[model samples]
Target: MPEKRRPGGNTGVWWRLIQTAARAGEDMFVAPDARSVHRGNRRAPRTEVFRPCLVGRPGGDPDREIWEGIVLDLNRYGFRIRSFAPFVEGDLVTVQLMRDEEFKYPLSGVLTARVVRRSEAGGGLMDFGMELVVEPLSPTSRSGRGIRPAPPPSLSRPGTRMHLADYISKGRGNKNR
Candidate 1:
């Protein structure tokens, strides 16, 4: 005896439903952008930026050759900069935002910071995580000058740091930082 087929073949309908669900079950979640992956607990939210800046030694000298850098991102306590200069961790660097009329955000005049993280940004360039050792930069808004802030406890000794692995192992590289 031949097996019976349901009315207009409900099997095809059931199969199509399974197929649709299988397609839906696939990994369709969008991946997050690496640049905007800032976890909570930040003192201030990061502001996306493409401002030009000069990274140099922490001095008021006007005759020092400085590394030309572009501010990739900015925040209250820190910002990220990309430059060709191979600045080492714990190095004291000064970052001065260029006075561009097209891109002005009132963060003028030298910012002293410590190189917290270093990452290869391809093309012989590097990305430096700058943590502002100085804040509230100017005594007056229009002064555009800042008195350098003392280094935090960890970077008190400039040009001195343990290996990256060692530093991370000690939990200094936590998300909070």
Candidate 2:
């Protein structure tokens, strides 16, 4: 009669057999080429570019409120804005990107961004790279009721800074600067 192997003895033999089989498989395996590895992989979804614009802070100092920026790049997840102003490392700011003026509302999203890196652009312009913490505002929000009116043509342009003194002097009881 064949002797039945105990649990410990059987386990040791089983482990040795698994190691031997794995070693044999490794020895016979061939490394795949980088290009071939991605042959059947599905392509990533394409991301559309949105034209970014300035959004005023509701109650912030008008001088430093409107930031000149552009949506450098974007995905469904988040976007990167190139701005002249230096935002702190972890500032919660409201960002707006322009869409069709007639029907499509502006893209407004609240992002908690961290200053990932900062570099100097020529002409004393400071560029900040921020990593967003919050999910971008949905398209529905832009189309919803209570959409704010677009800013004037002059303020809409990039690189426009209205100092506090300038704002007070130009105040005609109108929100448009």
Candidate 3:
């Protein structure tokens, strides 16, 4: 009979290589003074969900193909999405909400969002931090089908991110200088 290895037992020669690679997500320090630090400035609380959805450009560009992605976390203002395609900053995307993995039913026509942050999650996949860029459609348009309207001047076309404070300031007729 073969002996069973313990939980921490080394599998083989690649043990060191695998161990070092796995520490990336586990080693970020939140201490303000740390050389490598992490910060959480989110204003809205989020719900963690593993829902599938379709992502692509607005207006259904014929040349660009829509792709599938998983919503990692969602909140009122934004959500974090993981996809195989790498989206550039300032790129506007439309998310087609799906009922589930069966791909049989559609939940909503499309939600407009801007890619505020992007990071490589390895394995040719990427993680995107998206900010909802438009207001919800009126109840009359709530059949779960409506294209995104034109972006407001302050919200779109900015290479820099629009912080929550910026939004509040914009409401008071102040420009982000």
Candidate 4:
């Protein structure tokens, strides 16, 4: 004969009690506050997420020496970067968006980010997920449309190596120490 399955197994009493409480409209457990709920929220704005990106560290030259990285996800608040090199927590970085190829121009922004989590998929490959503590460049505010023009070939030229230092020095007058 086939074995029979019980209607309730472990914690049946607990489940019954929970159902009773729910039916009574007296919450057995309190709901978390807005702040607590927000803490667990991982959803970001559409614009910040799923946008193509290139990430690199700051270097001496403002125009060169930035290691390129692809942005896997982004939000208005922060972004997740995928790069060969690992980024430590609290590291500052600059992100560039390739808007268009015809113009060969890139919309760039600078922000300070801290590494929140690191996942390794083997073969010396690591994915760095960071949270942006500082605000990134707002393309909308600068041009009044919030949309950026095409990226310049100068920014994404093939075989071009622009160090983070070059960009910093030229744009912010800051040099890597």
TM-score of each: 0.49, 0.37, 0.54, 0.42
**What digit string (tens of lDDT, one per residue) describes model 1 on residues 99-150?**
6634345358777899987889999999998898955444655466655577
Over the stretch 14-67, how does candidate 2's per-residue lDDT look in tens digits? 675566455542221223553321122112222445466553333456575677
Clashing residue pairs for model 1? none
What does candidate 4's lDDT look like per residue over 1-177, in tens digits?
997767766577676666654554222222445322112224443233444456667665778545555566666666667666656766766666655533245766555667776767577766777777764567677766777678866655578788987887888856553
Q: Each prediction's Cα lDDT score?
A: 0.75, 0.55, 0.78, 0.60
Return the lDDT, model 3, position 102: 70
List residue ranges in candidate 3 displaced over 4 A.
Answer: 1-40, 136-177
Candidate whose lDDT is highest: 3
Ranked by TM-score from best down, the candidates are 3, 1, 4, 2
Q: C-alpha displacement of 71 in model 4, angstroms? A: 1.3
Write down the worst ten-residue block by lDDT for model 4: 34-43
State, as a TM-score between 0 and 1, how close model 3 is to the true structure: 0.54
lDDT of each residue in 67-154, candidate 3, tens digit only = 8998898888888899986689999999877897975678877899999888788899899989999775787578776757878677
Question: Which has the higher lDDT value, candidate number 1 or candidate number 2?
Answer: 1
- Residue pairs with backbone overlap in model 2: none
Deviation (Å) of 145 in candidate 2 = 20
Task: Give the lowest summed-lDDT range of ten residues in model 2.
Answer: 37-46
**Which regions of candidate 4 deviate over 4 angstroms?**
1-39, 43-51, 59-64, 100-104, 135-177
Off by over 4 Å in 1: 1-41, 60-62, 101-107, 135-177
